[model samples]
Target chain A: MKQKNDKSRAGRRTFLRTAGKAAVAAAALVGARSVGAQDKPGTRAAAGPVEGYNWNEHRWAYGIDTYRCIGCLRCVEACKAENGVSLDAHHFRTWVERYVYLEGEETARVDSQADSQNIAASGSEKEYRFDNRYKDKKVEKAFFVPKMCNHCSRPSCVQVCPTGATYKTKDGAVLIDHEHCIGCQYCVQACPYGARFFNDEERVTDKCTWCYHRITKGLMPACVEVCPTGTRIFGDLNDKESEISKFVRDNRVQVLKPEQGNAPTCFYIGLDKDVS
Target chain B: MEQLFHVAPYTGYVYPNETVFPWTVMIVVYPYLTGLVAGAFTVSSFYHVFGMEQFRPVSRLALLTALSFMIFVPYPLLMHLGHPERAFNAMITPHITSAFVAFGYFALFYVCLLVLEIWFVFRVDVVAHAQNATGLARQFYRALSLWSDDTSERARAIDRKFMFVLAVVGIPAAHGLHGYVGFVFASLKSREWWGSDMMPAVFLFSAIISGVALLIVLYITIAKIRRVPIDEACVRGLVYALWGFMMFTLLLEGVEFATLVYKGKEGIDIILEYVAHDLFYRFFVFQFGVGAILPIILITYMVFRKVRGKTFITVAFICGLLVLLQVFLMRWNVVISGQEIAKTMKGLLYYHVPVLGREGLIVSLSALFGPLVLLWIFTRVLPPWLDRPATAGPQ
Candidate 1:
């Protein structure tokens, strides 16, 4: 009877060992397959897509041709209407600055026509007489520089937000999660471009979302779409043949405050050294 | 050029968004309050840990002041928040890289340490009150005593040892509290006025100076009110320390400014321009001339000369008030002036103090004084007096 019991125990131990080994082999195979799937050109990662969006294909970039901008301010008006941005001059998601540089002058006189009424009144003149100070100076050269959220690859606003409320989308736009934002305004302080504002009515930090609502659904951002001179261009930089990528490659494009090291995606043609 | 939102008029072009300084006087008051708390606790630790016998008489008082001030530190912060209800989200889901996220932890840790140290120091007094008092007061004292009736020699010895440990621990915690506050401003690389490596040291030393000066003023005021003789040695020692720290703080600030001037950094001229225009009166006149230099000279004279009686107390008292004002101005200059210069370096902005709005002067002043009221009530309960004999437990 003792001999029979020992044989049975040895058989049970062998069976258990075999099962454990098989399970380990199975897990390793599954892990390898998932990693391999992520590396495949068209396959989504095993963790799945970002909620309500495809993270694999879309990557956005913005371009601005300072030469083409006629200082019309249509983009600014359209942005306000589309985003419900406050009409307060101090609060702007996007604005246009007319830079007037005089001959033999080290500095440029820059003025933003924050009021839509003022822009509409001035119309699309080559020489906008907004600032009287620049009127008397000998005109050297002048141009319009439209500025907005740079949608930086390394956004300081996203980095400084204490609650993870401001984040970069996989599609290359920096967005603020209003519900999660505590409105500490650390993001506002962190932004080198002066892009963000604390929206008093919404009680959240607000900035240019790159028109996320419009962009994801295959529509141009309000600023890009409403630009009459085709000064503002928005497209996918990931695609080699996209107009934005071509413009970036063909032109000597510059970013505002590149010294800040934010690696901004907003490229500009005809960017003057004194624009910052 | 018409003034908008009462912002200071500007000549050059400012980004439209840069016209309004988002941070206000309330934000200025936030750092000032935290600095006081850090400074007071540190002063108390000088007696407890370093055995600075001269500070012994006021050690408990300093601790109480710290506690009271710390209680109100969050009020200004909450008032500044757009969503005050979700303020705790900073702690709940704090981003690792963000400097402000560590504030909640640092504040909570320091407050807990201070509470424990205070309770341990006052354990005997609480137990005695529990035993001797009657009615609801007895119950209150009993609860404060944590129901620990043990006040034997062994327990007292243990409390002393624990207090020593806490004081040793508290020195860095206090420094961390105010140093972290400095970090919040200093870490912003975007703002040239605030982005200085020297900011934390400047803040910490200024806090120490303000704390010492505040205690001196309070000690003198309390002595006068109670008709008690002032401790001359204590006052002299604190004045000497205050002077030393003040000089050091000024040197740090001067070095920061000199570096900016010498480096000729891109934004330095614009910041200097803003300082020259709007901040000239506040920075040069009040902060440097009256608040700093005058106080230093007066305190030095009081310390070196054989001045005493009403004259000594009066001069010291004035010096204390001046140093306090100096520190407040420093906070204002750092927080508000930092925002005045636009990031574009093209123009300046202005901030007008609103009288009745949420971030108004009224709310700010009340927040500043609320802690003093709390301290008064706290003294009524704990009575941080050196004359009282150590309470004996039931024999």
Candidate 2:
């Protein structure tokens, strides 16, 4: 009887998830078609939602192990190239934040790869690097935390979008309907994670869509593929033997700003109090 | 040439995406203008809705002010839009969950209501001019009258009934639109500075004070310009209204600020630092001290001491000007200052207003004061003066 009850609950979950996916796929189809976006097959941002890819079969999620990150910033560079994000200090689809605690300081001093000092060190916004500001100081603790959109289940950006141009997918991705976007940027303000940015050239808000086109085609996101230390992880949550499921089962996992009630799909391991 | 983007200077660990502010000074003016529109409507309703005799002198002027300002209210939002061509998208495919869905509908409905009310109020004059004038002016008046030249008591009775009903409905429509603007900010839980239950009330009360204050300045200035006698009774009535609304604005603003501080949520430390340092002069010194409190004190003194003649006009005029500045600063503090406090809560950013370009200082000023240009034209065309005849007929 208990097993039957469990099976029924799982069935309900699948039904609701399928409905959400159908709506997303329909909207994406309408948006892409209306915009007349030319599909040059094999690109990360292929014109429309991928054909023959069933969103109902997969539940996507991301995981990060801060302990393994070395602040290499290769993932940042790779993400920009793969997603066609602007090469500037202010707009980043993915970034690495380094938290340093020197002796006698109770609070950690956090800076990202886009920090002005780091930008000056790298000598170009095209390349990404972290500055060596605290190398000589006696460090109490240090760690590099990779950051990206959490693709929250209850995304504020989706809620506040006046035109319904930005939406969250059933397979776990929050994406912008660029063609329909009025470019008010209210979504940019509503995002607590600061993951969304305004695309000045296009006059629209842009963000990391978890490389939707690649993922739908069964390829890894650019950041996950390039991480040297296996710091960033991406996998299907539905498959019992998937890496993300195993990672969740074996370790103590946490999320950034759980108090925000965003219900983020991105799980983190070894997150410090100062990470947010 | 246009600058594609302007990055704000920041300190500490702000999100890289936060370098460029989403909302600009034009957003600040958007709410400020809406506040004045709502406030001015409330003043007009004092005569129309509640039948206050003291308010009769400026009632027509008040309605004209509301209409003129309401017409230009959407100008700033359009100027700040990334795609001005798609400005109607919110109206066409408005997202239901979004707080912004009702704004376009509400503004359009309210504008229609205002136009209808104005038409009823001025139908007699339009008919009178249509019968007496010649050539272009005659054509204009005839068109304005919708080709009807009825001046009978029965026709006017229907006009009075319609005008009163429109004013009764307009009270909620105007105030609701302005309050909804506050709800837009309050609904966003991302920014601690904006997320508050009292935000709508605060915006509504401040709007009332600002509108009443504007009426004072306009009433006295227009009288001086046209060389007409200032109606002491009307000025006195408006002063009482301004003073009363000022009390609510101060209390609500003070309580809201105190509650924000006392709650001391996750980002309270940063909010405190921002309030003390970055927002000190614009918020504390000028907005609270000069704009709100000072006017209350001066008006109270005038009311009790029975300050008469030029002294009464001078005091009321000064208070009106100060409150207008105060409300403008209040909007700046809410819209701009709220954005300055980063979402990270670990840093703050400073936005530099540009002198030229679309979202620049010049464009913002035009959006702010352009309605006065429209108001001047509206007054010439409609002539909303109760005591004097409107552009006397040929007879």
Candidate 3:
């Protein structure tokens, strides 16, 4: 790094610049060409056709019904298998949060499959299982909140990516162009939902895309397909007859941490105050 | 191969993705290095723009210090990036909405400004060396002087005017660079610890003190090495700058912390817990007490007692070292602590500093102190000691 810097310094273009006033004024013309080539309208990494599907005609969204979740770990396994996510406790495209309130407990004892204890219980990072710590104690209430990328209308991750490598698709899913990400992980830090992780192997940031590959091809996200209880919902918001449309209309749903104003497209039913 | 990732150990519930620890110590070193550049430039400008004769002795040194540190400012950031080679993509195709989009422009403009200032300042030295020197060294100086050999009064006047303009413009360019770094952290709404409105001001004030403190330490050490009597007035000016800015930095930091607690935002519980526990020694004791308060109190005592000569220089030197450490700790507390606090607001993660490899203790320490090594090499070529009679003599 130091050698490269020195080489650049030695080869730097000299603009002779004898005029003091002109040199001072040089700073005034700082290149403010803020818009990137990809940021231009009609150039924003638009999705291509999948058979007869047109991304412009669809606004994809997802729904999570925590009440019906079984904590089976099947969705987590399917997501890893489908997306080729890093096999470790730290990286997850989608994971289930097990919120359990034992007797006399004021707060839910929340733990995810990524928890070290859970990782140890499963015997390997490739597999995941919630331990039985609360098996004997959680007699009051328990529910599993399946979490993934919200793909917000005003996604913080999209707003903070320096290279514009990750972007919000026209179809309403957030996607990353693996070819371009510099992997500064500013997006990872920007996400309030903690949905993003740096992929060390690829050296890029990755998150739950809601399985954009499958979704455009008229398929449910792998996690949703593998869900035993229909806990995860995926559909096009532009279609009134879509499952997500009814999921929104028939239920008093709320997006996670609405106070942030990212306006998440992922609607949740049976979400408790403690879910954040 | 480097360990793929070191998962942060946590107490309560934290998001699984957060366990990867998005930023390493390189991020902490990044801001700290940038702050040093800003601070050093401000000191150099005192002589070039403000024309403070007492500051003249160290002014050239300050300029060299700034340029040396400035040149390496992006090195740590590059080291942190997953694809360091594609770093220029930020400049080529910046995401307009990003707070970081303008970083390329700002840094480029400032570096050009600093380089121009250094060139104008050293033109006379370069001209003389180019005329009288031998071999590759002569060729190097000739090119550095832009192939010009003018050492006339007319050329000197133009150099002064150019240095003046560059320094004047550089004040904002310098402060803006540092202040923008602060904003980069502050603008993030996700982390409660970093998203403070006062962050930029706090960073700037601390940056000023850190720079002034660095000047004091370097000026004294260089003087000692050259076997010259340290310029008493120059040291006094630096001490005063250090004293005044240190107070402001301390107050701004204190107020910022107080406001964070008073507002008692959603994640206050964990913040308070972290502060009382892990942060007690690092933040309250080391950063606040021994590093800042002790130096401040000693400086105050020296000022009132009308301290002078070796006693004063020794005290000020100690204070300078302490203030530098204080500012470094502030950067650590802000950058690392911000990440250590879980975004879920329910837990704290322990960022384990790796012993060796890319994101490790050895690399981090190198990033922190490596600029001084560069500064030493810079002094040999440019010889930024024009104030002393012996060193300032004709080449």
Ranking by lDDT: 2, 3, 1
**What overall lDDT, based on C-alpha atoms, would model 3 receive against the true structure?**
0.84
Higher-DockQ candidate among 2 and 3? 2
- Scored by lDDT, model 1 comes in at 0.80
lDDT to native, each model: 0.80, 0.85, 0.84
- What tens digits encode model 3's per-residue C-alpha lDDT throughout B22-82? 9988998888888999999999988889999899888989998998888888888898899
Q: What is the C-alpha lDDT profile of model 1 across B47-121, one tens digit per residue?
A: 889989998778888999999999999999898888999999999989888988999999999999999999988
lDDT head-to-head 1 vs 3, winner: 3
Regions of model 1 farther than 4 Å from truth: A1-52, A114-137, B1-9, B390-395
- In candidate 2 chain B, where is summed lDDT lowest over 10 consecutive residues? B386-395
Candidate topping lDDT: 2
**Predicted candidate 3 versus true structure: per-residue lDDT over A85-113, tens digit per residue:** 76678898899998888899888889997
Q: Which has the better TM-score: candidate 1, or candidate 2?
A: 2
Cα RMSD to the true fold for all candidates? 16.3, 7.3, 14.8
TM-score leaderboard ranking? 2, 3, 1
Q: Supply the DockQ value of model 2.
A: 0.61
Q: List the residue pairs that clash in candidate 2.
A: none
